[model samples]
Target: MVPNVRSSLPVTGTKPRTSWPRKALLILGFLFALAAIALVAMAVSQNKPLPKNIKYGIVLDAGSSHTNLYVYEWPAEKENDTGVVHQVEVCKVEGLGISGYSQDTEKAGLSLQHCMKRAQEVVPEQQHRETPVYLGATAGMRLLSLQNRSMADRVLSAVEKTLRSSPFNFQGARVISGQEEGAYGWITINYLLGNFKQAFSAFYFVMNFLNLTTEKSPVPLDKATSAVESFCSRPWHEVKAEFPKIKEKYLSEYCFSGTYILSLLENGYGFTMEKWQNIQFLGKIGSSDAGWTLGYMLNLTNMIPAEKPPTRPLSHASYVGLMVFCSLVLVAVLLLSWLTFHKPKCLQKGLI
Candidate 1:
């Protein structure tokens, strides 16, 4: 017997099948993709380099051991925040600190001339008249003040005369207490760490206002090794009861400096030894030194205002990320719509 064959014809009575919903979806997807592209273009156009108007300040750190002159610069518009001012150059005066010239107090002022001349060279001439210069004599001067008030005053007067004679604006020259030194140093480190934005509580204010913490934090040890091993492994009371002994052989002066720092952190600031271990001591953070000089400059420039400035708009990185994420979502939607609307065509090609 021959194989039977049958022919099938389209049913003309029924309307041709149409998927309006699928077509609509595809049109919406395309429109969404176009909108995403437009948004990306708009964001790209708006992304421009921030205007960089640079400003400068000068500070002479007249310390007990020695004197150092520092030049700092920041964006003119951002002077009201922390970690913005950076030390561009530092000139260390030759010979002893200003206190060494107690007998010949006039020489104390002359000692700073070398560094001031260098400052003139470092900063622009136009900014010289407007740039304020400050002199903060540290522990050495403080001791002199206690020993002989008149001599200390004479030393400050001499330095003030020298600074006034210079082309720059002389703000003032005076001895800063050890407590202020420590507190300012703390501010410098915390600012560099960018911790101010994350935590600003009563403790922060108390530490800032009352404590004399320095910025020269020790390099960050592995937290697990330091805080966890030392504190977590032992009871808090036990750790607090006994202080760790220092065995490393460093400069003899470090003994005094270390004790002074510990006293400042504990007695001066009311921080526990365990809390001290948590603190990081760094010589330099990024490109700037972790010293009180930066804090001093910031104070003069009003970089750290009492009231926080208006919150800034979204950052550049966030803006870029948002654009990219939107673009990806739009592409995915477009692909899904294409697949859905063309199912029949895929089926005809034996692809579905």
Candidate 2:
């Protein structure tokens, strides 16, 4: 009976226990991945500071084709003149741009007034026009017909009359070249990047040498930029273009400088572009090159539409995917082992 038991032992099939170290290692690897992702998520979240109100802003985007009023406001304490800007809303009117400025000055002024009227509803009463409104006139304003010009003057005069009579003051209007406008947009974004809000912050004080300020600053030429109609997702620009400020040159320049897509990149994400006959990496921006400069600029404009958030946190999906893959691998291993371990017995027993 003892000999028969020993012989039967050779025929017995059993799975050996897996190494404890292997199981521990596998579990530890999964935990490590989760921790890494969470750490990254936390870092990204922390990097985005809450919106600050360095100060309020209002813009009159005047093109030869049309005109529109853009209003933005923020908390007084959190933001500075150049800090993170929180946009309230953009209020506009039909036929506001240069058509109002050029073709019909009276209508142009009405459009301007209408834009301001709508903006007044959105901006809070307390933060309301505490400071004077900077009425900046651009190309369309620069090119009005005599009748249109007189109409524009009357419209602005009426606007000034309203401001003087109201709780706020009209700080007089000024015409700026497109270059100055481009510089301002750059400045706004950079201030947010540098974390100093006021136009007169310590950073600017320290960096003013780099700003293009000179005893005789060159003025930008009156050039028309091409339009990138594909970029403007909303019809607001149509309202904007109604005034004729829309120009080919301005559009092209605006497209290159103010790409909403830049807002979407995170610190860890990267892309490659072929430039100067070389494939260049994007993530680790270095020494203020175009890619890195754009990256830093994008860091400030995080609220751009192109920077829309992900549908969900990466953890749940990534972890579940990893688990599925690991489980599939584990099942494959068990199947292979069962087939291998029993192959000899199956053959010997004529069970194959």
Candidate 3:
């Protein structure tokens, strides 16, 4: 039995299993390489501006004093976001506002033709069919509706007909409510200033402070602020009476417009009197005009998305730079590891 034992012994050639730590390191290295490649690709992609698909839209601010046609152009990619729309061109109609044509209601529609034609000139021909044109009559139309419903209807009908006849997609012409006009105006102003959400946060902060504080002095910061806001929210008539230096260059209907604005902030939107001081009543905020035209265009085309867009944790350039640095470190480590573990014994002895 002993004679055959040596010859019958099995010949084996099996590789040893990799240790858990070694396997983990290998996997981590592979992932690092993959991440570096991905970062590089992302950097390259971001470095080049993507082809912009330009979109066009038109909004007619049918205010009491005048009608203004604003042509807005934005990248199609950013259509579903706020503050992306910019007023490319503004065409002011020579005649009175749409409501001014109450007697000759047909002329109200005709007045918009020139503006719409100008819009066509500014917007590309291809976009005309797709471009939506909306007409939002302001205080003038609202007053007209209240005073003479038939005249207001006729004016709106006239404007709608004119818009429909044009090459652009005609949404409709209607008298926007005082609350909507005011709210949209607020949105426009805050959106332009990039303070829409910030304003709301400030309001909440003030409310919390009021709730938390036990001080009941009438002259407290919050009370003083509320008084100032109340003054601002007062109708223009009261303002003019209180401060005689306040001049009216435009139509004398500031009282009506201001009243509606106050209503919008106080009653419609439930903003307390204290918040009125924060709102801008002027025509312009910096270089841009603070009005509802921009907001209207943004809303009509669904430019503002309901959900916030996802943002990358790291910028493309930073990610790529980090990856590159890590890759170099990894290469150096690997080189050092090879030298430490795989160098020939004669070479190691000679180096020592």
Question: Which scores greater on TM-score, model 1 or model 2?
Answer: 1
Task: Write candidate 3's Cα lDDT for 63-142 as tens digits.
Answer: 87689888887666563354377778888997888888999989998888887888999998987898888889987899
Which residue ranges in model 1 land beyond 4 Å of their true spot? 1-51, 79-83, 197-279, 303-352
TM-scores, all candidates, are 0.53, 0.37, 0.53
For candidate 2, lDDT tens digit of each residue in 1-352?
2466765566566665568546655665565556556555655654556553334555555555555455554334332222244444555457646434433444545556666777667665665655345556555555543335565676566545544544443556555555565555455444434653422111121112122122233212110111222434436566347536654444444443423222221112342222112211121112221111222222333332222223333466665675566556556555555554456664658642
Whole-model lDDT per candidate: 0.69, 0.44, 0.68
Error of 1 at 347 (Å): 53
lDDT for 4 in candidate 2 is: 68
Could you tell me which 10 consecutive residues in candidate 1 have the lowest summed lDDT? Answer: 198-207
lDDT head-to-head 1 vs 3, winner: 1
Best-fitting candidate, scored by TM-score? 1
What does the lDDT come to for candidate 2? 0.44
Error of 2 at 318 (Å): 47
